[model samples]
Target: MVRRVVVVGIVLAVVLTPLMGWAQSKAVLPPIMPLRDIKPGMRGIGRTVIQGQKIEEFDIEIMGILQGGGDVIPVRHLILFRASGPVTDRSGGTAAGMSGSPLFINGKLIGALSAGYLWQPGKRELALGTPIEDMLTVLDLPNGTAQTPWPRTFAASEPFHIGRRAITRVVVTDTLAQAQRVDEAGLPGMTAFIPATFPVMVSGLSPRAMGFLRQALGAAQPLLQYDQEGATFVASPITGGSSVGILQVRGDVSYGGMCTVTLRVGDRLLICGHPWDQMGEVEYALTTSDIVTVVRTLQEPFKEGNLGDLIGKIDQDRGPAIRGVIGRMPRMLAVRVAVTDLDAGTRIEKGVQVVRRRDLAKTFAAAMALTAVDRARGQILGGGTASVKITLRAKGLPRVISRENVFYNSRDVALASLLDLPDALNFLLYNDLAPLDPVDMNIEISVTGKRQTAAIAETTVERREVAPGERLRVHMTLRPFQEQTVPSRVIEISIPRDFPRGPAVLVVGSAGRQVSLESAPEQGLAQLLQQEPQPSPAATLDGAIQLFEDYGKNTDILLQLIPFGLPPEGSEFVKFDVFAGEVVRTDWVVQGEIQIPILIR
Candidate 1:
């Protein structure tokens, strides 16, 4: 039969008074028992203070215990209850400010006070605690080794930029809103709350361009109101209340499109996630007469308001609510490029563009094609005039290239020109799309080539549902000079699900020969036809641990912990660690935390 669990509350407070006198006075008393020795009904005295007055009188009792263990240490549990104590202010009992109050059972450190009930009332209240055993799990001491010390404190580091470009800011907006009644009368009310509204500002570009954008915005009369099933309203959404309003507005700008502008709300300022590449000061103003819809009722009576009233109170002082001077125009495309050569080349280098746009596939293809041409042939070619033929090679589709058919003269030519295929394919796939329908396409290119001849190639197209964190592994076997079973190196490409599909690097090896190739979708499998491969780091748990240890020496905080429960029978426990760095001067921190999976054989 299962036993019922009893839940009780405890109150705790921390005193920061000097320990010298108390230490001496308590020397003769029996040494406080360690947390492990405490049991239910055990009584103890807690010393604390209230409002600057030193008080050493409070009563505590052990209520229950919790237990958990692992390979390294056994965790301890000590649940305590407050029998009597006037230790803190009435409103401050277990307040938010007291998150980590140390608890002692018979003078033994047992757990940290974590939570309490606000409705319990008076000096005798209940509180919950995280047992010392939980802390042991955090410290990776499942077996309870005395040598391992728990980290006294932990702090989150500021996010860092590790890739080629910094992720300055990512703004997400809600596209739909639904209304619910907060009161019985069903009258129109605030559905959403405006945290604060500052002038929407634009800067960085030439005065002519800025003026043109302003004019376009003013003349277009775009609606920025909250819409609920075609109904409109005019009020900021109330906190925790049900109403409909604009969800959010997100904007970000980076290199290749960096321009500075300052948005001000009185003395406040708005800037990018990170410092701008270029800095300057400029005045900002709200683009006037912007339409904003607000949904006031679930029924027929919806209201509409202008941007000004939606953001600012009519009776309050209103200047630019946002302030500061740094940032560029939002980008429409994430990776932009201009290419000069569409035909062929071994090494390619070109400029890249990052911008915002409605169609990412179209923008990405255009930029990639341009960059490929510029790097290969050294001149920008007209992509619009290129008559590109795309074939979907599948079980039932027509073949673009086949093993028995040679489409080009030489394999070198095939591989060199294959760098621009993704762009062509993307362009072909998304040339025309309906407003409500999403264009989706997936294709794989297989190329067979010889130095003297472009032997054969094929494109396989199919619809694939790709979700985040999904892994796609491409297996390639290289056969040079028609020799079967040549010794070839295998390189795996790990495309992070979050990363956009664009220019990517791949390594292939055959007969001890390695080659590096510039790859995009349009170039297809041709660019990889005859190239050698290069060495790549192993993507394994042990490999990752070694890499972190080598490069993470400078990290400020390092935590190694074993998970709860021992490895299954015949299996080894997996070790995990979390590393973090903090720069005190800038209040910046970088965290690298991952769980390493290990198999015990």
Candidate 2:
């Protein structure tokens, strides 16, 4: 009886599997119009939200098709659309946030509302459309390549082209998101045509912090305004013509664009009528968003919205559009931050859910950590002593990359103490090898009211010369920060047994790396990050350990004894011009430089 009942239950479960209910989620792929079939003087209408979730239609007439593009993209085809009717009167012309709005002619689909001219002396009616054929090609494309075929191009006289492409700023840790800019030329005649890379609504960042973000990111990353409405960000669904975000950040700082969802086939979705970053075959986080309202400006109009839960991965970032997949969360690097305030006797611990991206992983993570520390302390860190311990773990590494550094600055110790981790991550992310397989990261920061900086007041040496294998002692006087206490220490070392019978120099100075200076090459730093050669994403974690070790610490006290002359003919010192001590790394900001001459016999 039990065997018969169990088999009957199994059969019932199998039979009911196909009957499970999924709420009505329609994929509106009306109908497609091929570029070859489109001609001038054709009439149509399109749908998009000028404000809120209300879908409205505007009249459109095809002026003609364009026939010229660039070198890499040989496809010379884009449909020109002229606007009229009530939609034209309300919006004046094409909007920056209306890139992927679908157009229908004769009750069928044509393509997305992509771009428009930057300068407009009168009514806005001219715009460009990326053929439905190309936008559809984004559905199932591969890395570094697109499947869109070169359609036949027709000759059209003086057809208005899309605006110049300007890089968009994107970050997904806690604070900001920015889309692309079409007005790259910045001509004097144009009012302010920011018709690309829709607004990146940011939350939780003050104006000052937003300014700091600009400083930290520099020019390669675009800047966007701060939005407070995204504080209640949650996830929804990815459907056709719905607002979607290629989320880079969540939590307190919502940084990602409010873009239009172009198409959906099965579990696959297409979005961002233009490229988000155009880093093909990417695995970026995708989430649903709700349009709040459109802020109209003389320069440009934008849509501000709140991002919803992360539910998918953006599989491709190509020219025509960004494509994504639902039902799977993207792989992310885990970040944990602990801030201890001694004065208040309070400790705050926070965890950041950072997206795992090649160009964004390190910078975004570091910004998140910095924001966490700043928030825990109730303000930006300034004029205080801080001890930071950073632990880095990866998949294949035998041990964690542990770094402990101290900071002493009159302005802000926050940046100095926590800089190494970010720089190291940057090196790892931008390595010529593979992506870094980061397991988890912990940054333990302790703060105190006392200042921890001193300058070398005086230096005294035991002797001007020394014999081989002799021990030498050096005394130094130090001046503390605005305080009466003057503390000093003695550093000692022994001359090499086979030292050359010649003069030498002893150089003593501040130890750790320079905080104001950039540790990376300037030329490459200004440009966009290129794709790395990777066997697997985590291929270079081990070598990155060496890079982290070499960047030096800010709180370190660096001391060195250099033999000024060439070593006696056969000594190992011949390979080097100077003998730097084994302890070259430090966390202390160097305050003084002193050179003393000595003789080695």
Q: Which candidate comes out best when scored by TM-score?
A: 2
lDDT of 1 at 527: 30
Model 1 CA lDDT for position 52: 23
What are the lDDT scores of the predictions, listed in order? Answer: 0.25, 0.56
- For candidate 2, the lDDT comes to 0.56
What is the clash count for each candidate, in the order shown?
76, 25
Q: Looking at candidate 1, what is the lDDT of residue 80? A: 33
lDDT of 2 at 313: 71
lDDT of 1 by residue, 1-601 (tens): 0001110111212112111211121212123345456666677643332222122334556554433233454332324345355543332343221223445555554544433323233332344344443432322222222233212111111221212322221111111121112112233321211111111222122222223233333432212211112212222211100111111121111011110111122212221111111111211211111112212221111112122111211111111111121122222222322222233424433222222122323333333333343334433221211212222222222222211111221213223332333333332332222111122222222222223211111111121222224332332222323334333322222223443333222211110112233333223332332122222132443342233223222112222112224321111211211111111110111122222221111
Deviation from native of the Cα of residue 110 in model 2, angstroms: 2.2
